[model samples]
Target chain A: MFLETVLLAQRELRRNVLRSSLTVLGIVIGVAAVITLVTIGNGATQQVAEQIGSLGSNMLQLRPGQGFRGPGGASSDSKRFTLEDAQAISNDIPGLAAVAPTANASTQAIYGNENWSTSITGSTNDFLKVRNWDLDSGREFGDGELQSGRAVCIIGATVKKELFGGQEPIGQSIRLKKIAFQVVGVLKSKGQASFGNDQDDFVLIPIRTLHRRIAGNADVGGIMVSVRDADAIDEAKSAIERLMRERRRIAYGGQDDFNVGDMREIMSTVTGTTKILTALLAAVAAVSLVVGGIGIMNIMLVSVTERTREIGIRLAIGALGREVMMQFLVEAVVLSGFGGIVGIALGLGAAAAGSVVLKVPFVLEPGIVVLAFGFSSVVGIVFGFFPARKAARLDPIEALRHE
Target chain B: MNETPVSSNNNGAAANGAAANGALIRLQAVTKVYGTGIAAVEALKGIDLRIGQGEFVAIMGPSGSGKSTCMNILGCLDVPTAGTYFFQGRNVGRLTQDQRALLRREHLGFVFQGFNLLGRTSALENAELPLIYRGLPVKKRRVLAREALASVGLSGWETHTPAELSGGQQQRVAIARAIVTHPKVLLADEPTGNLDSERSREVMELLTALNRDRGITILMVTHEPDMAKYAARQVHFMDGLIDGRSTEGGA
Candidate 1:
C-alpha cells in the first residue's frame, strides 16, 4: 500500500512537471547558496590558520611602535632598538628561547651577469631559530664570522634562483653596495606568504658585517622574541614589557615608544572574525530555507483546494484519512528531497568554481552536506502537514459536490 | 450467497429464496438530522429498511426527499443521527470512522451520478483504485482490474482517460471501478442521470444483467420510473419516510 502511494505521488508530480519544479525551486536555491558560502569560508579559515602557523610558534615581535602595527607601521619618529636590547631580553627573560635583532636595507646584488634587487636583512644566527627557518644547505653565520665582521651571507631560495639559476651558490661571491659577500648557506623554500608576497625573496647576513660594510650603521628596526614553551609566553610577555619600558625610559602610566605584539593574539583575532562571518552567512542561508519552506506550503495548500474532486474520489473508494495524508506528505518530501540532491550538485560545482577564483582550498565537509539534505526533508514535513491534514479532513460528500 | 452465481432466468425464484434467508443489510428506525437546534432539518425520520442477499431494490424519491441521505447511510459514507444500521448482521453504527472505511473497502462499493472517475487517470488505474486500498499485489490487481473492465464492456478502453471517453463509456469505467473489489453490495446513485434515453436504457440493461448473472446485491437511488422498473422491487420515499413499496421486495 505504501509503495503504491509513493508511485501515485510520483505520477501526480509528473502530471504537472512545470508547477512541481517551480514549487521546489526555492529549496534548491536555498541549499545551494548555503553550501557554496560555507565551503569557501571553511577553506579560507583553514588557509589563514596554516599561513599563520607557518610564520612561527610561540613568538612575539617587539617593534618601535606605541601599539600594534598599522598600515604605515608604528610612529615613524620613534626611537629604534639597538642590538643591546636583543641581548638584554635574552639575558633578563627567564623563559626566552632565542632573541634576534634585525635591520633591513634594499639594494641590488650582483653575481656574474645576473643582478636582482632584493632586501638584505642583517641578523645573528639566532634569526633562524626565532623565525623557525631551516637551512636548505651549508651553514648559518658562525661566531667567527660575526666577531670578525666578515662578509658571509645566506641566500634565500628566490635570490639563489634569480642570481645563480641552477649553479651552486656556496662559496660564491655576490656584490651588494660594492661589498662582496660570500654565500655560506641557502634557506629552504617557504613559498608565498598569506599576503601574496614571496617569502623567499631576501638575503641574510651577519649583523656586524651589515653594520660595518653594507648598511654602515648599527640601527635595529625590530627584535623577534621566541619563548621556550606555550605556557611561558604570558610570563615572558609581561617581563619583557616591564624590562623594555624601563630600558626605553617610559614614565610610569605613560604609553611606551615600542610595541610588543603576540603572534597568538593576532591569530586569534583573525580566526574569530572569520568564524563569525561564516556563522552569519550560514544563518542567512537558513532564513532562506525557511522562506523556501513557506513557498512549498503555499503551493501545497493551493493543490489541496484544486484537487478537491480527486480527493473526494479517493475517499469514496475507501481511502482512510491517514492514507490521504500520507499521499500528500510523500509528495512533498519527494519534491524537497529531489531539490536537495540537485542543490548539492550545483553547490559543489559553484564552490569548486569559487575556490579557484578566490584561491582558497576546495573543502567539502560531509556533515554539512548531510545536514543540508536532512534539513530540506524536515522542511517538507513541517510545511507539508497543514495542507496534508486539510486534504485528509475534507468531507467526501462535500468534496464530491465541488466543481 | 443464498442466490445463484450463474445467470438465472428465474429472477422471482432467486429473490424468493433470499427473502426466506438472513438479510444482507438491515436499517431499524434510522433518523438523520443535518443541523442542530432551531436550524435542524430532518433528512430521515425514523425510517426502516431491509435488503436481502442478491436482491435488486430501487429507491425512488424527489429532490430533498432524503433518498440521497439514505443511500449515503447504506454506503457507509455517513451514520444515522438516531437508530441502528446493520451490514451482514454486524452493527455499523458502533464502528469507528476507520473501521467503517474498512467495511466499505471490503464489503461495499459505490457509483456516483457524476461518474466520479478520477480525471487524467487511465480507466484501468481508476478501476484498480479499490484494490490498492485493499493492499492487493500488482499482478493480481492488474488482472482483476482488467477483468472488471471487461465485465463492464470496456476491455478496449483500459488505457483511455475519462475525458477521452464518451459519457456512456465513462459511466462504464465507473461501474468497473465499483465492482472491481467483488463487493457484497453495490450502491449506485442516479447511475444514468447524465445520459440520454438510449444510453440510460443501455446502463439499466447492464445493471439488470449484472444482478441476474453475478447474483450481486444492488441498491440504487433514482428518480426516473423507467430506470426504477429495471429493479425487482421499488421503494418510494417522500418527506423522510418510506411512503410505498411495489413488486416482490418485502419479506
Candidate 2:
C-alpha cells in the first residue's frame, strides 16, 4: 500500500515538474550554503594545525616580556639575554635538545644586479635544529668561522632564489648592507607558516657576527629552545625559568620579566579561534534551512489546493484520509531529499575550489554531509504535515463540487 | 488499516437479506439537515426507500431537491440525521468512518459527473486505483484492470490518458475503474452530464450492460429523462421528500 501511494505521488509530482523543482530550490541553496561554509572552515582549521606542526610542537620561544602586546612591548625597555644564558641553559638543563641565542635585522640582499629586501638572523648551527630546518645543499658554518665571527651565512630557499636566481648559491658572496657575507649552505624550503609568512625567506649568520658587525651590542634578542620530547617540556621550562631568574638577579617571589611561549599553546589558540568562526558561519547558514522549510510549506499548501478535485476523486473512490495524507507527505519528502543530494554535490564542489584558493586542505566530513542531508528531509516532514492534513480533512462532497 | 468483512459474494447472507423483504438496502424515515439555527436547511426530510439486489434505480429530481443527499447517504459518503440505514441487514450509521471507507472500497464503487479519471494517468492505472487501496499485488491488479477495460470495450485504450481520449471514452474508463473491484453496487452521479448526446448514449449503454451482464445493483442520480429511461426503476424526489410516483419495470 505504501509503495503504491509513493508511486502515485511520484507521478503527481512529475506532472508539475517545473513547480516542484522551483519549490525545492530553497532547500538546495540552504543545504549547499551550510555544507560549503562548514567544509571550508574545517579545512582552514586543519591547515592551521598542520602548518604549526611543521614548526616543531615541542619547541619554545623565550622573550624578555611579561606578556606579548603588539611589537616589542615591554621587551624594548627590559634587559635582553646574552650568549651566557643560552650556554647555561644548554649545560644545566637535562633532556634538553638544542638552544640558539638569536637576533635579526632587515637588510637589502645584493648579489650582482639582483637585490631583494629580506631579514637576516644571526645564530649558531643549533638554530637550524631548534627551528626544525634542514639544509638542502652546502655545509653549515665551520666551528672556526663561528669562533672568529666570520662573515659567512646560510641562505634559505627563498633568499637563495632572490639573490642567486638559477646560479649555484653555495660558496657565492652576497652583500648585506655594507658587509660581504659568503653563503656557506642553502636550506630546504619549509613552505609558509600558519600566519602565511614565508618560512624560507631569511638568511642565517653567526650570532657574534650579528652582535659585532650589525647591532654593535653584546645583548641577544631571544632564545629558541627545542625540548627532547613532549613529556620533558614542563620540566625543561621550569628549569630554564629558575636559571634565568637567578642569573638576572630577580629576588624571590618577584614577577619575572620574561615570557615562555610554546608552539603547542599557539597551535591550540589558533585552532580554537578557527573552530569558533567555523561554528558561527555554520549557524548563520542554518537559518537558511528554516527559510527553506517555510518555502516547502507554502508550496505544499498551494499544491493541496490545486489538487483539491483530485483529492476528492480519491476520497470518493474509497481512499482513507491517512492514505491521502501520506501521498502528499511522500511527495514533500521526495522533493526535499532530491534537493539534499544536489546540494551535497554543489557544496563539495565549491569547497574543493575554495580550498585551492585559500591554500587549505579539502576536509570532507562525512558526518556533516549526512547531517545536512538528514536535516533537509526532516524539514520536509516538519513543514509538510499541515498541508497534508488539510488535504486529508477536505470534505469529499465539497471538494468534488469545487470548480 | 480497518478491515471490514466483504459481503458482496456472500450468497447465503444475501439470500437471507433478500428473503427478509426482497430488498438489499433499507432506509427507514431517514432525514438530513445541513447547518443549524436560522441557517438550517433540511436536505432529506423523513425519507423511506428500499432497493432490491441486482436492481438498477434512477434517483431523479431538480437541484436542491435532496436527490444528491439521498445518493450520498446510500453510498455511505454521509449518514442520515434521524434514522437508520441497513445494507445487507447491517446498520451503516453504526459503522465507523474507516469501516465505511472499507465497505466502499470492498463492495461499492463510485462514478462522478466530470469523468473523474485522474489527469496525466493512463486508463489502466486509473482502473487499478481501488485495487491498489485493497493492497492487491501489481501483477494481479494489472490483469484485473485489463479484463475490466476489455469488458468496457477499451482494451486498446489502456495506456491513453483522459486528455487523450474523448468524453465517451473517458466515461468508459471511469466505468472500467468502477467495475475493476468487482463491486456489488455502483453509484453514479450524472455520469453523462458532461457528454454530448452521442457520448451520453454510449455511456448509458455501458451502464445498462454492466447492470444486466454482471448482476450488479446500480443507483444513479440524474434529471435527464433520456438517461433515466435506461434504469429498471425510477425514484423521484422533490422539496426534501419523495413524491411517491416511483415506477418499476418487469423484474
Candidate 3:
C-alpha cells in the first residue's frame, strides 16, 4: 500500500511539475532564511562572549557612583575617587592582588614634527598587572621617577604604530601639552574589548606626572583591582568598600560613595540580554514558516478540487478512505522534506558568507540543523491534513460525475 | 459449454426431477426512488429477478427504462431503496460500503459505455490496476496482466496508452482490465457505444467468446437488436419495469 501511494504521488507530482516545484521553493526559502538569520545571531553572540572571556577574568572595576550607570544620566556628576583612596584599598584589602589609580584624557602628542591626537591614561606601575596588559619593550617607570612625578610614558601599540611607524619607540621623547615625556615602555596588543573600544590604543603615564604636568587635578577617575582568584572577588569587593568608607570618614550606615563592578557579573548580564534579543529575532523569523505552511495548504486544496474524478476512480476500485488520505499526506511530506534539505544547504552557505564578511568565526550547531528539518516535516503534516481529509471524504459517485 | 466445471452435488435432486438451475443472483421487490417530495423519480419499480450460473443475458431498453437502474444495483454501485438482494450466498443490502467494493472487485467486472480506461495509464498498467487493489505481488500481477492482454489479442500493445490505441483496441484493453481478476460475472453497459459498427462487432465477438467458450456469465445492456441477438436470453424493460422476456437459439 505504501509503495502504491508513493508511485501515485510521484505521478501526481510529475503531472504538475511546475506547480510542485514552486511550492517546494517557497518552503525552502522560508526555512533557509530562518536558519541563516539564527546562525548569524548566534555567531555574533559567541563573538561577544569570547571577547569578554579574553579580558582578564579576575579583574574588577570601581567607579565613583551609586551603582552602574551609562554615560548619559542625571547622576553623572559625582566626586571622583583620589589616588589616596586607591592606595588605602591596596594596603588594607587582604584578598587583593593589585590595585591601580587610573585617569584618562584625550590630548595632542608631539613627536619630532609628527603630532597626533591620542588618548593618554595616567596610572601607577600596578596598572599593567591589574589590567593584564603586557609590556612589548623597555620597562615600567622606576619608583624614583613615579614618586618625583617625572614625565616618563608607556605608549600603546596603536599609539606606537601611529607615532613611530615601525620604528622602536622606547627611548623616543614625545611632548604632551608642552611637557616633554620620554617613552620608557610599550604595551602589547589586547584587541577590542566588549565595549567596542580598543584596549591597545592609548598611552600610559605616571599618575603624579599626569596630576602636575597634564590635567593638574588631584581627583582620579577610578580604581581598577585584580583579585587573587575568581572565588575571592566578592569578599575583596566588600573589604575594599569597608576600608574606603572608614578612610573617607563617612558616618555609620552611610552609603559608600563608589561602585565596585566584577567583570564576570557584567559579562553574564550582557550575555543574558543579548540571548533574549536573539530569541526574539528568531521568533519573528519563525512566522515565515507558518505562512509557508499555509501556502502549501492552499495549493493542496486546489489540487484536491482539480483531481476529484481521480479520487472517485480509486474509491470505486476498492481503495479505502485511509488509502486516499495517505496518498496526499505522503505527497505533502515529500515536498516539505525536499524543501528542508535544500534549505539546510542554503542556510549553511549563507552563514559561511556572513562570517567571512563580518570577520567573525562561523559557528554551526548540529542541534539547530536537526531542529530545522524537524520543523519542516511538522509543517508539512500539519498543513497537508485538511486537503487529504477533503479528498478522503469525497463520495465516489458524485466525484465521478464531476467534469 | 465444454469449459463448464462439473458439480455433482445435486445428482439425487436432479434424478428426483428437480431443475438443475441454481440462482447466482436474486433480487426481490427492488425499487429505486430519487429526490424528495414532488420532484421524486421512480427509476425502478418493484423489480424481481433471478439469474442462474453460466447464463449469457441481454437487457434491451430505451433511455428512460429501468434497465440502467437494475445494472447499477447489480454492480453494487448502489443499493435498492427497499428490497432484499442475495448475491451468491450473502445478502447485499446488509453489507458495508467497503464490503460492497470488495465484492465488486473480487466477483464482478465492469465494462462501461465510454471504454473507461484511466487516461495517461498504459494498457498493461490499466490491466494491472484491479490486481494491485487485490494486493497481488508485482511480478505475479505483471504476468497476469500480460496474459490477460494477450488473450484479448493486445499482447504487443501493452505499452500503448489509451489515446494511442484505436477504439477497438482501447475497448479490448478495457476488456482485458475487466477479466484480469477472473470475476464470476461481467457487466457491460453499452460496451461498444463509442465505437464504429465494425469495432463494435469486434468487441461483441470478444464478450460472446468469453461467455460461450469460457463459460463465464455475462449481463449486457444494449439498444441494437443485432447486439442483443448474440445473448442466449433477452429481457426488455419499459417505464421502469421489466415488460417482456424471451429465450433464443431454440429448435
TM-score to native of every candidate shown? 0.79, 0.90, 0.85
Cα error, residue B190 of model 3, in Å, equals 3.3
Q: Candidate 1's C-alpha lDDT?
A: 0.87
Candidate 2 lDDT (Cα, 0 to 1): 0.87
Q: Find the 10 residues in a row with the least total lDDT in model 1 chain A.
A: A67-76
Model 1: CA > 4 A from native: A57-82, A88-98, A102-192, A195-222, A225-269, B1-21, B245-251
Candidate 1 C-alpha lDDT tens digits along A34-140: 88988888888888777777667588888886766532244467898898998999998898889999888889999999999998889988889987899999998
Across residues B81-135, which tens digit of lDDT does each residue of candidate 1 receive?
9987878867788898889888899888888889999889999999999998888
| Rank order (by TM-score, best first) | 2, 3, 1
lDDT of each: 0.87, 0.87, 0.81
DockQ of each: 0.51, 0.58, 0.37
Model 2 lDDT tens row, A1-403: 6776677777888888898888888889888999999999999999988877877888878888676443223256678998999999999988878898898888899999999898889899999998788999999989999888999999999998887879999888999878999999999998876665777898999999998888789888889999998888888888889999998989999988887777777778788889999999989988888898888899999999988998888888888999889888988888888788888898899999999998889999999999999999999998999999999999888888877
Q: Write the per-residue lDDT of candidate 3 for residues A165-283, one digit (tens) a residue.
A: 87888888999999899999999887755556777778899989998888988868888899988898888888877777777677898886777877777677777777787778768
Candidate 1: pairs in clash: none
- Sort candidate 3 into its docking category: acceptable
Better of 1 and 3 by DockQ: 1
Scored against the true structure, residue A275 in model 2 reaches a CA lDDT of 96
lDDT of 2 by residue, B101-193 (tens): 888888898998988888889999999988888888999999999999999899999999999999899999999999999998999999999
Q: Pick the candidate with the highest DockQ.
A: 2
RMSD to the hidden true structure, all candidates: 7.0, 4.4, 5.2
Write out the backbone clash pairs for model 3. none
